[model samples]
Target chain A: MEQIGLSHIAITTGILLILTGLWGILTQKNIIKMIIGFSLFDTGIHIVMVGVGYVEGKTAPILDEAVQLKEAARQIVDPLPQAMVLTAIVIGIGITALMLAYALRLYQKNKTLDIQKFNDLKW
Target chain B: MIIKIIAIIIGLAILLMALIAVYNKKLIVAIVAAGVVSLFASVMYLLLSAPDVAMTEAAIGSGLSTIIFFYVVNKIRKNRKDHA
Candidate 1:
């Protein structure tokens, strides 16, 4: 059997977190709770990205005096996922803020955070 | 060897905290629990040799996001108080 490594552990944790967050989003009645779930989901995705990019026995993507240019690619983990996750994190925060703003507006209209209270769409 | 063990523990802790965030009865506790999950995930990122991601997660997840969540919660509570 292969030994456990950082990637294995991170990937597992990320997937579990995604599941937990999905449960929160699906079952939660409060809008705030759903927003929390969204945050969890976002974090989980980022973790997975970093995990997938991780290379065994590699240092961080940054190039410093310790590593030579020719060996930099072999010495460091992939930088692509890190870059993607960085952008995603910013977008996630923006989306979260937008959701919270919407929640506040909805609460103002109905004086309730409960999703069931706004039933205008019902026929 | 030791890093793997630490990762396992961190993973378990994140899972438990996430469950609490999802299932807990109290809103404040749930929010705090979610913040802890972010902090742990950041640590996990560091273990994965993604220091850049780890720093961003630590700053945004544990700091900015928590503050935003708390602000929203406080606003809702204050509004509720006014309505009642």
Candidate 2:
């Protein structure tokens, strides 16, 4: 039984990455680490979506009648995930870039990157 | 059964890496390990048949984020040695 195919591995890895990212966010004292955690979390979700598209031995979803369309479709991998991952990849980059800019600004304001050290604004 | 075992091993390794990222004292090490964790996750994505995700993971997770982190650390550390 090939029950444990690629999706199983991808989903498991994605979940693990999210959990690890959460753990990092909760335990780390640095803002940069927290950002890193966030990135990991984002990666986890993206992978999950992409993994959902995988069909064992399926060809890329494209218009092709040379190879019986119906049977080909039976084995064709979903195209939706590719589109979703494309969107997600761009979004992830945007968020990371923004977060890095924020980190830089925060460092400028506080002169340190330690989250614990920035308690002046907290009532 | 064999594929299941392989998946289990990969999952366990990811868990271990997560733990190390959370518990490691050095910030640099944690960031690097986090990148590795993402890189490994990308490979797992490939295993799961998501080449698109695998490509994204390789690019953003391991590539862009790591560079941004290195810059953030260097920028901050240059001024504050104690925090470094």
Candidate 3:
């Protein structure tokens, strides 16, 4: 059997987190719970993105006195995914905030947070 | 070597908290559990050699997002009490 590594552990956690989020999103009747599920989903995706960029024994992308400039590329893990995850984290929070605000507005409109009651598109 | 074990432990903790966030009966408890998941995930990112991502997840995911969720929850509660 292959020994588990950091990437393996991280990606596994990400996948499980995504599954948990999906379960919550599907089974919960409350809008707030659904929003929390979405947040979980976003976090899972971020974790997976960062995990995929890991090198076996490399350091982080940031350069410091410990890392030589000429050998930086060989010494550091992939930076593109890290940069992408940075943007994703910010966007995830923005999306979460927007979702919460929309849920509040929906509750205001009907005074109910139940998913089944807002079935305007049910035909 | 030992870092791998630590990573595994943290991963399990994150998964457990995520399950709690999904399956808990109390809304506030669920929200706090989700915040814990984010914090643990930031640690996972650090282990994966993504410090920048780790910092961002810590600050934005666990910090600001939890506050916003709590704010919205409080607002909803106030709305319910106002009507009741």
User: Highest TM-score: which candidate?
Assistant: 3
Q: Which one is best on lDDT?
A: 3
Q: Where is model 2 more than 4 Å wrong at Cα?
A: A1-5, A56-70, B1-5, B81-84
Q: Which docking band does candidate 3 fall into?
A: high
lDDT of 3 by residue, A53-98 (tens): 9988899877899789999989999999999989989988888899
* Local accuracy of candidate 2 as per-residue lDDT tens digits, B1-84: 565566567667766776776677787998888788777777766666556667877888788878888887887777687554
Model 1 lDDT per residue over A12-82, tens place? 89998999899999999999899899899988989988999899879988888867899997899999999
- For each candidate, give its TM-score against the true structure: 0.96, 0.82, 0.97
Highest DockQ: give the candidate number: 3
Pairs of residues at least 3 apart in sequence or in different chains that clash in candidate 2: A6-B48
Model 3 CA lDDT for position B29: 99
Off by over 4 Å in 1: none
Worst 10 residues of 2 chain A by lDDT: A58-67
* Cα shift from native, residue B25, model 3 (Å): 1.3
Prediction-by-prediction clash tally: 0, 1, 0
